[model samples]
Target: MLDSLLPPLNEHNLPYPDTIHPIVVHFVIAMVLFAFVCDTVSYFTRNPKLAEVSWWNLVFATVSIFIAVIFGQIEAGLAEPYDAAVSTLNLHSILGWSLSGVLAAVTGWRYVLRLQNKPQLPTPYIVASVALVGLVIAQTYLGDLLVWVYGLHSVPVVEATRGGQL
Candidate 1:
């Protein structure tokens, strides 16, 4: 029955080098973390200069997310489709896209607020940043589960047998 939901695993048809996939994932995760850290710091410091820097960080993050999304789609295509793992990947994708929107909104709001000479961190700014951080945590967990629980890719045992370690 599980087979009905999940495409059978194919070890020979990987979309990219295993090394490449993990590296891209790590890089993308780092980008998101950087954005989250910038957001939090800007919120606490209430420094308009830091907010400006955070806005640039968010722009870089958005660009990185676009690249990450492409890589993720490729990875997903390489994995079994319709399985629980893919389902979780789907959830992660939704949350990731939502986060991009939220980040964009926050950046725009900050820009406008700066233009208006009201550079103080507003209550909504704090609330949105908090929500974005929560979403980042959830998305990170989903990414971990996709690799750790689903066995969609090579496990450590297989890697060791293949004379490699991930």
Candidate 2:
């Protein structure tokens, strides 16, 4: 049974070399950033039209983030972190979960603002969005460290894991 689970692979390997988390996550990151930008610009210009763009982006990102986090958790679990990578992996995991909650809460708040038919986002909410961006930047850095620095699911790591040597 275990043998069947662990099939042989070549350098050409599993659909992609790494986990699918990053592929999905980049969408969330882009959406969140763009949403914030739209909101900020609309706020300064007092053009409510951009709010529609921001709201839709936020909605899509809210849904996409969960998908990204699910894949992230699964991939993180499967990662065979070396001693040096363990701390980084743990930080990345913690930040990913934290960001999920923050993103959901902000989405809910935005929904409320939408319901209220406000002309623009409240200053506080915009500030919160700025903070969210900061956290996201930090999260991106950590994720990069894991994949680029630690090489979590790189072809070599995958090969080692498949061979029970990771």
Which has the greatest TM-score? 2
Off by over 4 Å in 1: 1-12, 19-28, 155-166
Question: For each candidate, what TM-score against the reference?
Answer: 0.69, 0.88
What's the TM for model 1?
A: 0.69
Worst-scoring 10-residue span by lDDT in model 1: 157-166
Candidate 2 wrongly placed segments (more than 4 Å): 2-18, 159-166
Candidate 1 per-residue lDDT over residues 97-153, each given as its tens digit:
776676667667756766776646677766776776677678778877776775556
lDDT of 2 by residue, 1-166 (tens): 8767775543424434556899999999999999999999999988888887998998999899999998888778777677888999899889988998999899899989989987778999999999999989999999999988888878777677668775
Estimate every model's Cα lDDT from 0 to 1: 0.63, 0.86
**RMSD list, candidates in order:** 7.1, 2.6
- Per-residue error at 166 for model 2, in Å? 6.6
Worst 10 residues of 2 by lDDT: 8-17
